[model samples]
Target: MVYTMLDKATLLPDLLRRLDKLPQGHALDLRTYKRNRSVLIRRIGADAFDVTEDGFQKERFQVPFSGLKKLLKVLFKREFPRSTKIRLYALGAADGDDLPTGRKVI
Candidate 1:
């Protein structure tokens, strides 16, 4: 498969779409490089997410899927806002991934 890069402008929205399709209890972690601030979003219910934010302040709360967007804005825009553009550090489950294309495991 070809590699496609996503910018901040597109990353968040694409992430939301993937989150919407994720199975319950699965988590998607979003982190920034500056302060190592990251938000862990876990699908706890059909319409809710269990969120935890860290870096500037540590807090945890549950919100509807739509609320996840607002929460991200608050943290990334208000709390630890960055002045320059950079990549979104997502997909924690793939940390140090090694498998290449067309490889499947059962």
Candidate 2:
């Protein structure tokens, strides 16, 4: 799901809700060029996940999936607003296999 600020403003809540149902191992990768950062969220358990960020010293943090809701809210409210450029990519297993690369969502 390549979400822009506009998409986040309008569909963030719904998106998060759906994400909560995703099976373990699902991942969300967020890219921000302006901030020169990339964040990876990988599900480790039903409600547990790990977050990895690129920076001076690549850091990894663990938080419940619920925490992502707050994180997204903060990003939408304070960091990415209006036209701030951002891209989010979602990946998960499909029948024990990775989703096809050529499959288009829309």
The most accurate candidate by lDDT is: 1
Tens-digit lDDT string for candidate 2 (14-71) = 6576568867877765555354455566777888877665533356677887687776
Q: Point to the candidate with the largest TM-score.
A: 1
For residue 92, give model 1's deviation from the true position in Å.
8.3
Clashes of 2: 0
Model 2: worst 10 consecutive residues (lDDT sum):
94-103
True-structure RMSD for candidate 2: 6.3
lDDT tens per residue, model 1, 6-74: 466666678788788977756665655343566667777899987777667878888998788877777
Backbone clashes in model 2, listed as residue pairs: none
Q: Per-prediction TM-score, please?
A: 0.67, 0.58
What is each predicted model's overall lDDT from 0 to 1?
A: 0.60, 0.58
The reply for model 1, stretches above 4 Å from the true place, is 1-6, 83-106
lDDT of candidate 1 vs native? Answer: 0.60
